[model samples]
Target chain A: MKILIVGGGMGGTILANNLARRLASELRSGKARITLLSASERHMYQPGLLYLAVGRMTPDELYRDQASLLEHDIEFHVDPVEEFRLDNNEVRTKSGKVHGYDILAIATGSRPAPEEIPGLAENAEQFYTEESAIKMFRRLQAFQGGRIVIAMGVPHKCPMAPLEIIFMLHDYFKDRGMLDKVKLHYTYPIGRVHTLENVAKWAAPEMDRLGITYETLFNLKEVDGAKKVVRSEEGGETPYDLLITIPAHRGMEVIEKNGLGQRGWIPTHRHKLTMEGRNNVYVLGDTTNLPISKAGSTAHFEAETLGENIAAIVKLGAPVRDYDGKVFCFIEAGKDRATYASFDYQNPPQPKAPTRAVHWFKVAYNKLYWASARGLL
Target chain B: MARRTVDARGSFCPGPLMELIAAMKMVAVGDELEVLSTDKGSASEIPEWLRKARHEHLGTEEKDGVWHVLVRKAR
Candidate 1:
């Protein structure tokens, strides 16, 4: 069996490692082969970008050589898939190489589309990438004090990032002794401060306590960079000296170009973790149109399930088990305090009050994430 | 009668439990497994999962900030 995994993000990497281990004997006997193709040679710890924007972590600390993180037997490549010929059970890479597989897993991941919103890319400060994060940090450093408004769109990766950044900013200015000089306001596209009802309930009063003002039902219409104002579709305009945004997210361009699914998200089986109609093709992480948080943990759990089922199909002539849509994310409430959310498809997460101990654990997890990616933790 | 110790310390929430479940698959129906995890959620979650999977939860104890959850395979 030739197993091809496209995109070496968290989901693909973990799945590769897990499958390599479970099929070790088969691989040695030439009964199975595993290959991974990714866009970059460096694997980034994406959650570190938030810390990067706050000056808590540096750029060099967020990456490792992608090949170094993989198992010895797995065939790793830097050529990214440009076309997905699902009907032919193969994907064509940028290097004009087409690889066919008996079983395929697509985990191309999603990209934050700040350009989707007019004037957002030019005016607003975002920390979705390393360069943008560094720039945002520099902008924050230069501003002495003023109105800093947080604006965001829906269906973005890392559901807790907006809240985490807002809270972190409160502490950032507080530490700089400019808390009283700056007015922090937040605007969300939804009817509440967060997409999840419980999180929104917890955050509204927390913002009120911190004096961080918020306006809900505030869809981002456009930004007037010259006037330093952002007008919402809800007929409200907010002016600011600094604008931080979590722009809307869309799946990778390759997915759309290949006519796979709308907006890059391939229709996937929520439980089986397979492409809706393709039994041998698996969809994972932000690549799947599952109505779950596009967090690393979501990918990790899905990868685990996919690994077991694929290995079973090779050995048992059938597969067992299903992905339960498990997702766990730590909410960094501030620089020193944090909490977490744990839930599945049938259950919604009930986050607790933020605690300092949990914050330290999140700090530790930052370093431990590499180990997790290695499928050891 | 067989027993296995799965020391899953330093792992995050659900990871420890997942490791224990993987171990459960390799053991016999009557085998007992002890999972050691540092994540606070695992202390309760391991037993919760055992209950749902129809496995017998032997006991759970926390020692030096690490939790040890014991269970026996039922099916």
Candidate 2:
């Protein structure tokens, strides 16, 4: 079996490792081949960026070379995916190299692009990506303090990220004794901090306590960089010296270009992650609209099921595993504490509990989870 | 050596680790702390972490699908 996986981030890496280890016997017998494709040589730990932006996590902790994450048996191609030729069961890279597979797994994660926002593209910065977020983090440290606007472009990845940023910024400025000069403004389209209402109820008190100015249900229509003003869909305008934004995210263009994507994402079977319209094709992680948080933990869960289902599909010719869409994310609130929340597709988010222990868990789990995926643990 | 039970059941990830740290602080050396966790990741991860931290991993037993892991504070 030739298994070609596109996108070598959380989902792709996990799938590659799981299959490589589970089918090691088959692989040793020359019965299986796996290929991982991605555009970058670097694999970033994105959740760390929330900490990285506030100097809680070092830049080195947030990125790793892609080859380090995959198993030795899986062939990795560090190049951009240009198109997916479904007819031939092949994916063509930007270099025009075409490789055929019996089964294709698309895990090409989404991109955080703010170019569509008026002045946001020109002046606003994002903490969603490594390069841009690091620049903004550095810029924030040098700032003596000004009107800091942490806003979100619609459909931003990880809806709670901007909220976490503001909370940590409060702690950062408070530590520097410059809290008086810094005014934190948070604006998002959702009526609350997160898409889930129950979470917002619990989080509202923290924003109030921290004195962070937040306006919910406000759409970001435009940003006037020169004037330092941000206009919302409701015609509300706010000014800022710096804009840290979570931009509008879109699926990989190659998938859409190949007619594999619907709107900004590829459609996949809710449980199996199989491509909706294509057989022997699977998609996972943020590349699909799975009604789950586009998070690493969720990807881990999906990878577990997807790997099993794919193996069963090839052997028994049946999809056996179903994704529960479960995800657990630790939200860092500075002050050496974090909150834990678990969300499943079938149920409401469970109540969250904040503790210093969760904070340490977040710190340790980051390393442990990374190590586990690479089998370092 | 004495044994103290940390009721970490229903606690989320990393919470167990933190509770262990705090419990270790309060107890004397050579004391054993047993953590009962419902999170599958924590149940598996705690023993490996104890080994790496040079703490003694007494054992991990499963009951009704819940995990009970015991560790002796070596430090």
Candidate 3:
């Protein structure tokens, strides 16, 4: 059996590692082979990008070579996928290589589509990638303390990241003794400060205490970089000396080009994680059009279920596991403190108050994540 | 027991743990090393790691909002 996994992000890599361990006998006997096709050689610890933006971590510490994370049994292909020939059970890469697989897992996670909103690419800065986070670090160092606006473009990965960035900024400025010189503002497209009601309620007083002006129901329409203004669809406008925004997120163009996505996101069964209308194809992580936070923890939990199911299907001819849509997130609350929330499709997360211990846990998790990529933790 | 102190206060998690492990390498067997960290998780995690590594855990104490963890290299 040949298992072809696309996109070597958190989901793809973790699933590959899990499969290699579970199917070790089959792999050693040449009964099954796993091939991971990734566009880049580096696998980034995306949650660390927030710390990278604030100078807490360097760029070198944020990622590892994808080859280093994969087991010897799994083959790594550094080629971009051009198209998926689902009807023929074949995948064509940009390098003109066509491979046939018995099982296909689409783990090609989403990317920030800055072009989705007019002028956003030119006006706002983002911290989603290593380069952008480094740029934000330099821009922040040169900032002279004026109005700073942090906005979200909706459905972005790591929904808690923007909030963490804002809190870290507060601590950064306060440490520099310029807290009073700068005014902080946050705008979200949703009706509340956060998608989770419990989190928003817990964060309301904290935002007020930090002197941050929180605005909701502000959908980003256009950015006027020259005028240093961001206008909402409702004609609401906010001006800033610096703008840090999370751009709109969409699935990879390759998936969309192959007509596999609904509005650029792959549609999958919420619990089964199987691609709609396909039995052998499964989808997980940020690429799926699930109403869940596109965070690493979500991918981690989903991988657990999907990995088990794949193993069962390959060996027993049927899937025996189901994903619960459970997600966990650690929200950095500044002052070296953090909070965590965990929930699934059936239960709403009860907000836990921020604490110093939680902050340390987030920090420790970053190190554990590297081990996890190698299937050691 | 003479103890050498490794002050890792204000450093993030794994930072303190890594510092403790590095400090352990420099110390002679039976010598104690104390790590001071403000990262709250280290208060418990350091000892857990020490136990796994077969080091003698002297215990942990919080002083002035900082955690002081002591361990003696056994191997």
Q: Quick one: best TM-score, which candidate?
A: 1
What would the per-residue lDDT of candidate 3 be over residues B1-75, giving only the tens digit for each residue? 568877666432114665565355456889999887766677766776665556788888999888999889887
Query: Which lDDT tens digits does candidate 2 get at residues A74-115?
Result: 898898778788888887888989999999988888887787
Native contacts retained by candidate 1: 0.00
Task: Compute the lDDT of residue A319 as modeled in candidate 1.
Answer: 75
| lDDT by residue for model 1 (B2-74), tens | 9987765543322466456536645899999988776667777667656645689999888998888888998
What TM-score does each of the candidates earn? 0.83, 0.80, 0.82
Candidate 3's residue-wise lDDT over A1-377, tens digit each? Answer: 89999989999999999999999999999999999999999999998888888889988888899999999999999998998999999999999999899999999998888887888888788898888989989998889889999876655778787778888999999988899889999986544576566788888788998899988756677898889999875457999999999876777889889999844678778789989899889898888866667878878888878878888987999889778768888999985999988877656678788999999988999889988877667
Model 3: per-residue Cα lDDT at residue A121: 84
Ranking by TM-score: 1, 3, 2
Task: Give lDDT for model 3.
Answer: 0.82
lDDT of 3 at A309: 88
Instruction: Give DockQ for candidates 1 onward, in order.
Output: 0.01, 0.01, 0.01
lDDT of all the models against the reference? 0.86, 0.74, 0.82
Candidate 3: the clashing residue pairs are none
DockQ sort, best first:
1, 2, 3
Q: How accurate locally is residue A287 in candidate 1, as Cα lDDT from 0 to 100?
A: 89
